[model samples]
Target: MIYLRRMDYTVIVYHLLFHLLLLTLGFSPAFCFFSSIKNTFKWGVQSVGNAVCSGVNCCDFHLNDNVEENLTKLLKDKLFGQHIAASLLVEALSSHRTHKSQKALGIGLHGWTGTGKNYVSEMIAESLYKQGMRSPLVHVFAGRASFPDGDEVKKYRKDLLTWIRGNVSDCGHTLFIFDECDKWPVGLIDVIKPFLDYHSVIEGVDYRNAIFLFLTNTGGSAIGQRMLDLHEEGVIRDKLKFEDFHDEISLSLFNEEGGFFKSDIIRGDGIDFHIPFLPLEERHVRKCAERQFELKGYSNPTGRMIEDVLKNMLYGPTSNPIFSMTGCKRVHSLVLSVIARLKLEL
Candidate 1:
């Protein structure tokens, strides 16, 4: 009995001495104990989540090879010159990461009429959805909305406000694609000023948790002119003043026109803006076109026709301008145009 009592007293003393030593070393006994327990729990949770997802959605992520390659290359841009659009997307999504706050990003995607900005934006949206992100995307069709019947500025602004409120009320974050931004009335633009600046109020909540992607066909020449007027003089941030360009519209002409015919300022206060252009590389264009055609039930087009299509659709370097409106319309009209005309089976 004396031996057992002595052993218990020794154990108690040892524990008390150990705790004192920890405290002397600037460690709290409770903190150490709780930290160890918390770490063990976290490790177990992570291990289980990884093990279960490894055979499911994790593997599905590996299926989109070409998309992976493209996105990987885009994300690797050091200067972010070639991947501005993708960078904005990453920023927008990062804002909504679990535990992150209600930040937002906006971008204005401007290019020529056939520059493929819409297609690129759609691809980015689909990629996010595939990655199991909860970000919601909406395609704003002005025709479908009762906005701006040529001059319905108030109605348009209201419609846009409603759309934004709907998204915020339904989800944590959203991607709003405002098409034909240049067509927005100046009055309506003023109405959306708060929203553009991430100061828009929805009910009692501040809507600073959305990404706005505005697409327009306005030229860079016009953008430069507008920037010169709006931005302070002699300010260079990466690119030059928006007005200078080597396109068919000369700088002098663009300045005289006050920018593009449909030009407007897209304030990206907390938003990312992208102006996606058609792919310059012939190989890239061919691959994209082939995939597009395949999806549209065109099994094959003759090598010559394919070349012609590329030339017309993408009139850049190493591409022929043979792709015209009539040709595109014809190809889109029939399901068996490839089998019948090209005599190639799908």
Candidate 2:
């Protein structure tokens, strides 16, 4: 037997203690050893211990446990207008997370620009993942940006399948967002139809835990017209229900000259919910402006400043300009300009 130096005993004790802490925190002994050994050898024990702890903290999955509570708070606090869309999204996600599902959850968000389709998607991402849209598990695709040409449908289809399969294989709980879906070439969306279907497993991957969101302005006109008709009929916008406009939005999606036009996804009921985002009124625009000012670091925006922001916005229906034409899409730039002008006045 060989004699041991005091320094050697110290190192051995430190190593055992470090791994003991990892084991107590639920890490496997093998995983702890693999994650820390290289660093320990290179940087000495103290630095390696800190590095291992930091790595473990940062690398864990970031999905929060109180999904419904967090999501409801985000929607109610930050989002303006579209009460029905807000409620439906929270309910759908809550129920999906709580129970076992047979098919991947599919939500199609249809609306005009700045009507909170993308904003709602971001809220959902934030609620589900600590990193929000930046999470590796969340994949976003734009139709015009990703698949611009009608002729390249075959190649796009093949690549799309491979990407979805690989991502789901890596993490079964994944989110796939397809923005501007209406701009994708016809018949292209059917490429992922098998994955979205009720199949228990597709090529050894169980996709039931995944979520797919399709955002489009395909049914904006019809939705806007329906809102106008409802307003004329004295129906309060907040009081409007999903059933009120679901059929109209569905018809537009089916007949429109876009991705979902007569697509099997629609005919086969692959899309679980076709959520319609309603047009914003003048009050809603004001709320957006106020929030924008706060975001731009102006906490207490005066009434004059808010009115100025509103005056710069274009609202419509030539006969009666009751609603914002561009929603709150241009609110950020508009707020900046207003702030600059106000500073000059001061």
Candidate 3:
């Protein structure tokens, strides 16, 4: 009789284990060992995801969502040239980030090298997230550095899509910047077309709530020509308006011979604006020198040093008029060098 009882107990234990296996595989997660544990784990993960997508607990970093206050902060000090572009940037970016809006904000920043294209991009991040390039929402991909020759482009496309989809799913308010896009692999831009599409939200990834900025010197020469044309006609450089170069820039960007030739990002109506960053002249370089000097902890300014800095920089166009080829990009280093020399001379 004791042997019979032992056999019965063994049967009971087997049934219990079988029941648990069914419960876990059929009703709960197949990966979990226990049914109750799986239910609770899945629920917790789903709840967190929901909170993030709904705009709660999305940013680990602090961000100022105010528009006008942010605008004031953007224009208060620093950033010398491109006032019109700055105003447009504040107006557009403020609305895009703060208000509930649809479609990704596609901004094409075009200009000569060192002409504040990258600077403006930095300022945009600073105003929005206060971390500038360090923002969790901002992703910068440079052409040569990112898409080097090889089968890397293939892998990069997969990673890029995954990153965008995953992040946009987590938080709809994401920002992507592609710098020096002129040198991007020939077929790479084509792969990004769908993500830039209006209202393209896949697998709970709402890409419409994101922002995309493309910076390049692809149309710099054309832009220079138009500015030179305006100057020749007696239009003050400061008076150069968006209307003067907007259409020309758009046309140039989409031209077949251009670096971004036939790019859907340029051709498509999805792009919100083509912001032209004008070339910096001597006066603008001086303004940049002043800012750079102040940044170096200089309480006073020197005229001789600033002029020499300007003279050291190379100019271009080699025609009726010329402008700073290096823009204010080299001014900071030049400013510091001149200051050190002057102090030693004194």
Highest-scoring model, TM-score:
2
lDDT of 2 by residue, 1-346 (tens): 2344567558766876887799889998788887567645654654444444331133345466788899899999888998988999998897777889988999999998998999999988898887788777789999889998899999999999999998888777789999999999999998878888899898799998899999999889898888898998999888999998988898898899999888898888888888989889989988999999999898899999898888988887776677798999988898999999988989
lDDT of 2 at 270: 89
Report RMSD for candidate 3: 14.2
Model 3 lDDT per residue over 247-292, tens place: 7787777773533777766667666878888888888899889888
Task: Tell me the spans in candidate 2 whose CA falls farther than 4 Å from its real position.
Answer: 1-60
Q: Comparing candidate 2 with candidate 3, which one achieves the higher TM-score?
A: 2
Q: Which one wins by lDDT: 2 or 3? A: 2
Q: What TM-score, to 2 decimals, does candidate 2 have?
A: 0.83
Give each model's whole-structure lDDT.
0.46, 0.85, 0.73
Worst 10 residues of 1 by lDDT: 322-331
Best by lDDT: 2
TM-score of candidate 3 on Cα atoms, chains taken together: 0.78
Distance from true location, Cα of 147 in model 3, Å: 1.2
Each candidate structure's count of clashing pairs: 18, 0, 0
Q: lDDT score of model 1?
A: 0.46
**Residue 220 lDDT in candidate 3:** 79
